[model samples]
Target chain A: MESKPPDIQLRRLDDYRWEVPQTGKMRTRGLIYATWDMLPDIRTDQSIQQVANVATLPGIEGASLAMPDIHWGYGFPIGGVAAFNLTEGVISPGGVGYDINCGVRLLRSNLLRQEAEPILEDLVDALFRNIPSGLGSRRKDLKLTTPALRQVLRLGAAWAVKNGFGTADDLLHIEAGGQIPGADADLVSDKALDRGRDQLGTLGSGNHFVEVGYVQEIFDEAIARAFGLFPQQITVIIHTGSRGLGHQVCDDYIKIMMKAAAKYNIELPDRQLCCAPITSPEGEQYLAAMAAAANFAFTNRQLITHWVRESFEQVWPAGPRALGLELVYDVAHNIAKIETHTINQVTKKVCVHRKGATRAFAPHHPEVPEAYREVGQPVLIPGDMGRYSYVLVGTPQAMVETFGSTCHGAGRLLSRHQALKAAKGRSILQELAAKGIVVRGASRGTIAEEIPEAYKDVDNVVEVVQGAGISRKVAKLHPLGVIKG
Target chain B: MVNNSDPPKSKSGYRQLAHTADLGFRLYGESLADIFVNAAHALYGVMTDRRRIRGLECREVVVEAPDSGALLVEWLNQLLYLFDTTGFLGREVEVQEITSQRLQARLRGEPLDEERHQLNTGIKAATYHNLEVKETAAGWQATIILDI
Candidate 1:
C-alpha cells in the first residue's frame, strides 16, 4: 500500500523511540514512537511538521509527541499529546480537537468466545436498535430536562448509575471513577445544553461505534489472566463522546484562547494554538466547561452500557448469567486534564492535553481504582469495527517519559471521501460478513466510509507503544459484530 | 447600531461587517478585538436571507469578553444567541472602526419573522479550524467556519 507519512527527519534512539529535532519555527524537538519499519510511513506524513509546530507554542513542556497512528488533523495531529504550564503557558482547542471527550470502554463477559460467535448476529441487531446512531440520531427515552441534564454535567457515570443505569461497582472500573472533578454547568451554553439534552445515551455520527469481539491471543500469560482476559472470551467495546455540547465549549473557548495569547504577548507560530494562563478566568471557565462535557461523555457511555447489558438479558433470556456479559473497564480520550507532573524533581501542576491520546497511568498511582491499582490502568484502544482491537495496560515508563499517555486507536489512513471512493462498487457488508463479522448502520455510506482498509493496522500501532514500553499488551480481540453511527 | 459602550474583550464581543471579502461580507477592524464585532454582523447576515434580515428596528447589543479571541467567538456566538434569545436577524451591516481590542458597528435588519429562526445546524459555536483574522497588505481581513 502507498504510505502517506510526513517528513520526519529521524534520529533513531532505540528499536522503539525516535526523535525529530527542532527545525523551522520549532521551539522544542518532536518525538515519534514507532519501530524501525514504521519509520518509512512516518517520513511520508506532514504531521511531523505539525508536531514541531506544536512545540513552538508558548510554554509547552517536554516534547511535542505523536503516537504511531499519527495523521494530520485540524491543528494538532490525531494521536497527539502535549502538556503546557498553566502558570505560564496556553491551551489550544485544536490540541484537544472538536470531539471533546471522545473515548472508549471495554466490557468483559463470563461466556466463552465460542458461545458468542454463534449469537453475534442477534447481539449486533439488538445493539443497533437500542443505540440510535448515524448523524443526528437521538431517542425519546433518553432526553433530559434542563435541571436533570445539569446534574449529568456534574455527575458523569455516577449520575447514570444513580439513575438506574448500573450499580455503584461500575464506577470503580471507570477512568477518573467515571466523573471528572471540577465540571461547572454554568460554563455550558444553553444551545450546547440543548444539543446534549437529547444526545445522552445515544451514539452521535462519524467514527462512533459499538463492537462485539473475542479475545484472539494473549501476549502475556500473567497480565492476561490478571485482567481476566483469555483466548476466545467474549468482550464488548463502546466508543463515543460528549457530542455537541463539548464541541460548542471548545468553539466558545478557542477564540478566547486566541485573543488571550495576544493579551499575554505569547509568541505563537500558529494562531490555532490560542491559549491563556491556566489561572486566568478565560482558562478556568473553559476547563470547567470542558470537564462538565467530559462528564456528559462518561455518563452517556454509562447509560448506553446499561442498555448493552440489558440487551444480553433480552437476547439470552437469563441476563449476564447466561450471556456472560460483564464490565471490564472504561477509558476516555480527547481531554485536557490538570495533573501533577514532576519536572526537575519537583511536582508541578500542568494541564496535559490528550487530543487523540489516552492516559496509561502506571500501577499504584493514587487515582487508579483500588481493584486494579496493583496492576495498572487498563487502556482500551478500539480498531475499526470490521477488524480487531486490543487490551493494554499502563506502565511506569509512560509515567516517567510520556506523562502517562499513549495512543488511542488505529488512526485513519484514509479520509471519509477517500474511503467512500475506495469502497465504490464493493459491498462492504458482504466483505465483512465473508470475514465472519456482521455489520449494520443507519446509512450505506457509513459502512463504506468505515471499511477496515480506511484505517492503519491497529496491531502495528499497538506494537509501537508496547515496544516503546509506554504500555504493555495483554490480549487481542477479533471482531464478530458491529453497530456504528 | 451596536451599543458598543465598551471594547470587545477576549473570547467575547460584537462588530460590523465591511466590504472586505470577495464573495462574502467581512468584519474589519484595527485589532482582533473590533474585527470580532464585525464578524458577528457577517454571520448574522448569513443566518438570515439578506432581504428578510434588512430593515428591522435595530437595538443595542452588548457582550462581555473573557479575553480577546474568546471575545471573537463569543461575538459570533452572540449573534446566534440573539437569533436564539431575541429573534433579531441581520441583512446589511456597517463597521465604523475596529481597535486593538474592540469594535463599534451598525447593523440594519428585521427581527426574524417567527419562521426564519429554525435553520440551525446545531453548530452551537464557531471554531478556528479555518479561522483567520489577519492584517493584510490591503487591509484587515478574517475568515471563520462554524462546526455545523
Candidate 2:
C-alpha cells in the first residue's frame, strides 16, 4: 500500500465528510465529501489541490466541490462539480472534460433473473456484435451527409427518434429532453466533424462499456416501480459518450479558447482553466461547438439503442417483446447546461458544468418526464465492471448543496499503467468469471487495466451521497457480463 | 554564444526539433508563414523512425494551429491523426516553415518505413498537460504530452 501524501490539508467536518479549507489563492472553500475511511485514499491524489484551484476560478458561485468518488484527471478531478455565476463567471473546457456529454443510460426489461439467465450468453454476444467496441471503431451502416449530420447536431436525441431509432417518448425521460438548446454544429471544425463522422453508433474505448445486469435490491418501492425496476429483474446499462468526435471538438476549441482568453485578457492561473467569459465571442463559439459534439453523442447512443433492440430480436424473434426491454432514463455525466437556481432566495440562471458528475434535478422540475415528475429525475451511477452499479434519484437536498449533482462512478484508485502492472500475474477475465461475471474485451490489457481491484469500494461512495442526500438510492445492480474496447 | 546545446536554426525565427516522449518539442514562429513548416517535422520523428524521418524527400503539405499551444497540439496531433485517419505513415519528414498566430506550417515526408507509433495505444491528440515552450539558458526548450 502506498502511504498517503502529506501536502493536502484535510479537515473533518463530521464522520462522513472532509473539507479542504480556503487556503492560499482560493476564492472559496474547497469542499470534499468523503468520510475518514476514504481520507487515506483521497490523500493519494493531487486532485484535492485541483479542487482548491478550481475554487479560485473567477465568478465561481458555489464552493468548488469534489464528491466521494474524487480522483485525479487531466483538468478537473473526475468527480468534481462547480457552478459559475452566469454574468461574471467563466467556462473552462477542463470542467466539462474531453468527452462531451459522456453519460450513462439504463434500460429495463421484463425478463427476470431466472428467465434471462439461460440465454444470457447469447444476449451478451448479440450486444457485443451489434455495437462496435474498440479504439477508432466505426459503424459501416450509418454514414451521415454533411447537412444530415449538422441536423443531428442541432436536434440531438430528438433527431435519433425522428430518424426512427427510438420513439419520441424516450426523449421525455432524457435530461433537457435530449436536446440542449444552442448547439451549433457549424462551430465544430472539419477535423472534429471528420473524426466524428465514422464514430457514430460505436463505443470508443477506455472506461466506456455496456453491461448486462439485474436489479439486485430495491430501496424505494414506489420509485422502483416508477423506474420500471424490480428485484431479480434483468437490466442493461449503456455507458459511452460523444466518441472521438467529442474529443476532437474539445481539442479544436482548447486552442481557440486559449487564444480567446488571451485576446479578452482573461487572467488564468492554469492554462487548463483557460476560458473566455461565458458571454464572450470566444466562449460563445466554444459553447456552440461543445453543444454540437454533445448532440452527436446523443445521436450515437440513440443509434446504439436501436442496435441493442435488434440484438435481442435476433435471438428472441419478436424484438424484445418476448424479452421485454424498455427504456428507463438516460443521464449525461459530462456537460454544461444553463439552469435556474435560487441564489440568496433569488432565482438566477447559471451554467452548471458537470465533469464526471451526474445531474440530479428534483421531482417536478419542468425538464423531468411527466411519469417521473413525482419520483424525481433518475440518476444512473455505473460503479465498475466487477461490483455493483446504482440507480438513484435527484433530491431537494441536491439542489441546495451541489446545484443538483452527484457522483458518477467508482473512481479509479490506480492509473491504467499501474493497474495493468498489478494485474500482470492475474487473468482478469478468469477472475471475473470466477466471481460469476462473464467478461469480454478487444484486448487482455484492456481487461487488466479495467480490473475491479483498481477502484475504491463504491458502497462507501454511495453512502456519502446518500448521507449528503444529494441523490437517493432506488436500486442496486450486479453485472452479469461486460464488453469493452 | 556559450558552448551549450541549443535548438535548431529556422528560416524565420523558430526552432523545430525532436525529443523523447517525456518532453515534446514545438517551434512557434508566430508568423503564419512558419507554423506547419516547423510542426510537421517535429511530429514526424515520433511517428516514424527518426533516421528514416530525417531522410525523407520533400512532399509539401500545409498545416495550421489556432494558437501556439493548439498549433503545438495540432501539429503533433496531426501526425498521429494521420496514422489513425490515414495510413500514410512517415519514414522521413522535414518542415520548412512555421507560424503561430494564424497557424501555418509546411512539411515533406516519405511513405511508411517504420512503425514507432505502435508503442502507443491510439493517442487521440497531443494534450497541453505540463506543456511549455520557453527561452531557456540553453536557447529554447519545448515540452508536450500526447494523451493516449
Candidate 3:
C-alpha cells in the first residue's frame, strides 16, 4: 500500500464536494463527492491519493473524480471516474478494473411483499439451488462449445435471449442493448474462452448476490410510476460481473499494455495504471477484448435472470409473467465507454472510465432508452444485504459535471480480515434473521466477510449524490431474502 | 518424487494482508525460485485446502516476460487458468529454472473433486499494483493483490 501523505491537502468546495489542488505533475485537480460525515473515513484510506495520482495521467480532460463510495483499489480507486480526450488521452485497464462490466440488474415484480413473505424461505432456497454460485461454480447443463461461446462473446444478453433464456424485450432494458458494439471474439484468448465455457449462469463468489426485496419507500411518485415501481411491490437485484473470462481478458491485456506504455513512452505513476494511446493498436485490441468479456457478463446475468424467474415459478407455482417479474434496467458499473461530453462549452468525444461508478445519463439523452426518456435512466445502487438499497434517476447535473456518472454502492469501510475478526463469535446469519431477513450463503466466512458493519452507511452515500444534484432519489428497496455466492 | 502431502518446509512462506476491497498476500522466500514456488502455494492455499490435493498429475509451464513483476503475474495467471478450465489444482510447484525474464516449472496436482475439497474463494487474477520482487534481509519478498 502507498504510504499516506502526511499532509494531504484539500479545499472544501461544499458540504458534499472536496477538491485536491493541482500540484506537481497533476494536469488537473482531484474532486471527491462526499459529505463531511464520510470524509473522516474516506481520508483515512489511500483512495484520495489515488485520485491525485489519476489527475497526473496523460490527457486527462477533467479533474480526477471519485464518487461518495470511494475506497482503495489497485490503481484507480473504486468509485473513481475520469474522462480522457479521444485524440490525446490514454486507456488504462486499471481504470476499468478486473471485472470489465461488473454491474447490477434490477427486476420489478407485481407480487406484493405480504404475499411473498410466507414463502420467502422456500423462495430463497430455490434461488440458491437453481443458481450455481460460490467459488468454482459452474453449470453442468449450460456448457457452451467454443463456437457457441463465441456467439455469446459477440451477442451478450441477446445471445441468452436467443438461447431461450429470456425474452427479446429483455434486451431493450439492458445497457448497450445487451451487447456492446465493437466486441470481437477473435480478440479474446483461448484461456478466457475455456474459463468462460461452463461458467455462464453461475454466480461467482465475493460480494456477488441475488436479493429479494420490496419497494419500501418512494421518494418520487411520478418517477416511481414511470419506473414501474410501487410501495410494497417485490423486486430482485442481481449483483455480479464478468467471471474468470473478464479477469483473464484484463490479465492478458495488462501485460500487453505494460509493453505498450513503454513503447509509447507514456510515463506511469504506478505500473498497474499502464495504458496506451486511445488510437494505438494495443488500445484498440484491449477495448475489443474488454467488450467481448463485458458481453459475456451481460449474457451471464441474463442467464441468471432466467433461472431466478424459474426459481420463483417453482416456489409460487406461477409463471414469471404472471408474477410481473419484468426487468427494470441493467447498468454496467465498471466500464469505459466512448461518449461525447461538453467540456468548457465544447462538445468533444472522450473515453469516460467509470470504475465502481454507474452511468447516469440524463433524460432525453440519445443513449437513454426511449421507454425511460422522460424520467431519465434508472441507476441501481445496492447496499449491503442487511441495509436498504436505492433506486435513483439520472440528472442533467450528472451530464454536466460527472460526464454522466454517479456512485455505485456503499463502499467498504473494513477489510475482509477485519470483518472476519469482528464477526468471530456473532452469528451473522442469525443476526440478520432476527431482523426478518432470510439469508443463504455458500460459506459462513463469506457471510461474515460481508457483514453490514463492514460497509459505510449507503444512505449517507446516496444523500451526497442527491445533494450534489447528480442523481435524484426515486424509491428505496428493503431486502426480504438474499442468496450470496 | 516430491511428496505433495508434505507442505514446503521453507522459512519463507506467505501471509494475507489487508485491503479494503480485495485480497492481498505477502510472500517471502530464501531465493527467487523459492519465492516463485511459495507464491504458487499461497495462491492454491487461498482457493482450497492444499493438503487434500494429491500429486497424481504433473504439467509443465513455461512463461517468458520482460520483467520479474510481469513474470510473477503470468505464472500465477497460468495456475488460475488451469484451475478455471480443467479444475487442475497445484499440490506442489517445482521451479526447474528461474530468472527475471523467464521461468520453467512442473506443477503437480489433480482435478478438483467437489466432494473431497472445500473450496474457499475464487481469485480473478493477480494484479500489478505495487508489485515488486526485491531482496530483503530475509532474502526475497513480494506482495501481490488478487481481484476477487
> Which ranges in model 1 have alpha carbons more than 4 Å from their true place?
A1-8, A23-25, A43-45, A321-324, B1-127, B130-148
Give the alpha carbon lDDT tens digit for every residue of A1-485 in model 2.
11233487777887666778888778888788888888777766567877888888778887898888887655677788988887888788888888899999888887788877777778778888889876556777887778888898899989989988988777876777778889998788877777777778898767788898999999999999999889999888888888777888887778777787788777766677777789888777888888888888888877888888888788667655676677798889998877888766878888788888999989987877899999899999998899999999999888888888999988877666567689998888888888878877755666776788777778889999999788999999999988887
Clashes of 1: 34
Q: How many residue pairs clash in each candidate?
A: 34, 17, 0
- Provide the global lDDT of candidate 2 against the true structure: 0.74
Model 3: per-residue Cα lDDT over A57-141, one tens digit each = 8889978999999988778999999999978799999999998899999999989999999999999999999998887888999
Q: How well is candidate 3 docked (DockQ)?
A: 0.41
User: Candidate 2 regions off by >4 Å?
Assistant: A1-6, B1-71, B87-121, B133-143, B146-148
Q: After superposition, how far is residue A343 of candidate 2 from its true place, in Å?
A: 2.0
Shift of residue A444 alpha carbon in model 1, Å: 0.9
True contacts kept of each: 0.09, 0.13, 0.67
The candidate, 1 or 3, that scores higher on TM-score is 3
**Model 2 in CAPRI terms: which quality?**
incorrect
The ten-residue window of minimal lDDT in model 2 chain B covers B14-23
Ranking by DockQ: 3, 2, 1
Say which docking band candidate 1 falls in: incorrect
